[model samples]
Target: PAASKNTIRVNSPRVRCDSASAEKKKIMCTEAEIEQKRLAALAKRRQREQEQQQQQKKR
Candidate 1:
């Protein structure tokens, strides 16, 4: 009975820890996606500005 109880206790926490990590991973994935999108937008804006400056110089 003691060994069985010990096994149950250990298994419960292991399951809980696994679920917590899974949630954390989901949040991290969303954050990474958002960062990628933001960086892409900034890069596009910078390119547009450079093109405009070149156009102005042609005049």
Candidate 2:
């Protein structure tokens, strides 16, 4: 009975470890996507500023 209990305890933690790794992967993917969006926004802002400066020079 004690051996069966020990086996159950080990199995439970292994299952939890698998789930935790999957969750970590999901979090990493989201973080990467957020970083990409932030970079794109910065690039767009820089382009707009450059365009404004060009218009000012033309005027």
Candidate 3:
């Protein structure tokens, strides 16, 4: 039987180990992107707050 959309049917008689499994491995891309975004956001927040505080002091 061929691999069906609804059900997975292994054509091979011998069960093979799923080593090329991207599912088992942790995806490193999105995590790094998220960290970078978070850092940029924090820096923006700090800069805005600092500018506001300086303005308040001047006034």
lDDT of model 1, residue 36: 100
Candidate 1 runs further than 4 Å off: none
> lDDT ranking from best to worst?
1, 2, 3
The predicted structure with the larger lDDT, 2 or 3, is 2
Clashing pairs in 2: none
lDDT of 1 at 13: 99
Candidate number achieving the greatest TM-score relative to the actual structure: 1
How well is each residue in 1-59 modelled by candidate 1, as lDDT tens digits?
Answer: 99999999999999999999999999999999999999999999999999999999998
lDDT of each: 1.00, 0.99, 0.70
**Pairs with steric clashes in candidate 1:** none
Q: Whole-model lDDT for model 3 versus the true structure? A: 0.70
Per-residue lDDT of candidate 2, residues 1-59 (tens digit): 99999999999999999999999999999999999999999999999999999999999
TM-score of 3: 0.57
Taking the tens digit of each residue's C-alpha lDDT, what string does model 3 give over 1-59? 34473254453322344443443444566777888999999999999999999999999
- Model 1: weakest 10-residue lDDT segment is 50-59
RMSD of each: 0.7, 2.2, 7.5
